[model samples]
Target: MATTALFFLFAGFAIACAVSMVYHRNPLYSAISLVGVFIALSCIYITLAAPFIAAVQILIYAGAIMVLVVFVIMLLNLEDDKPLNRLRYLYAVGGGLGLILLVQTFFIFYAVMRAPKQTVDADVTVGKTLSIGTAMYTEYLLPVEIVGILLLMAVIGGVILARRLEQPKLELVVDNELERRGEGEIKDEFRIRL
Candidate 1:
């Protein structure tokens, strides 16, 4: 099916980008990979027939968040950091075991808490933009506004940090050079250094 194929494609791309984001040494490259991951997530939403969610994923995650990250990277000029060191063998083994156990516990809890799907009216639009907007404004407006303000503050801070400082005064102007230098004394220091 088209949906299944798209789902797999997006999922693979998302995983690739996420891995690249983590492993890339360049901050700008990592930000770009993160944008790719966000876009792949948006595609997954589209495959699920949730166009509203897809749009938000594209607009907020890929657009706003990625831009902010890129801007911060540019502002900070952070290009010197090296890639992460490979983990030690014991640490890697332990982490793998811990991850497996965590996943197992999550599945067990999910299975225990699983609920039967209830039938709903067939007329409901699962991906309606208007409905999503209404819900967000009604239920999550405060949180959304707070996040927006935080982003604005971050942008302002970045701008302030990135601003260039005024050049320091080089030399004080002398109205009459005769006072500083003896009259008729040849100032020969202007010779070209070539």
Candidate 2:
């Protein structure tokens, strides 16, 4: 009951924040909302007993990636006037069709899988971290390290891009004597003295 209640709470918060992220006009606000959504999703994953996934979600998505997004948005000084309203109906239709097919496949599998008639003992189950850690380190260690390195690179890249200096604009200030003599050339346009 507690799990179900927590699931619903986190699920609702995640969906609400996701919607806010899409609809908010301010880029900073949208980025913050997206971070909120990611954090809520991480909580939901934790409630599902997937601690490793939850840790990764919080560490990578909510912590590093969202911070980069927020920094980039702020550094760009983005205005809120334009919203990304361009929608590709074909992509949407294809995605909907794919989701429907995936749901159908799941239902078919669930129907075909027969229930085990044997009684199971819960006490024999290995500790969650022990089994999961063994599998991840032995089978998926390389990929996991590679992903971490990629994420670190992305963070460094984002910081570099965001902190890039803006080009300085040159100002042309011609003196009064030069103006009177018509010696000043206004960016390739010269005027003759009358």
- Best by TM-score, which number? 1
Score residue 17 of candidate 1 by CA lDDT: 96
Candidate 1 residues 1-194, lDDT tens each?
A: 98788889889999899889977888899889999998999888776667888898898888887797899899999965654476557667978997998899999889877977675543365676777778779999999899999999998999999887653333122313533766424433322222
Error of 2 at 106 (Å): 10
CA displacement after TM-score superposition, residue 105 of candidate 2 (Å):
12
- What's the TM-score of each model vs. the native? 0.58, 0.56
Per-residue lDDT tens digits of candidate 2, residues 71-128? Answer: 9998999988563367667668878997998899899888768655564344333324
Residue 125 of model 1 has an lDDT of 55
Model 1: residues with Cα > 4 Å off, grouped in runs: 83-126, 137-194
Task: Give the poorly placed runs of model 2, Cα more than 4 Å off.
Answer: 81-129, 141-194
Provide the lDDT at 49 for model 1.
64
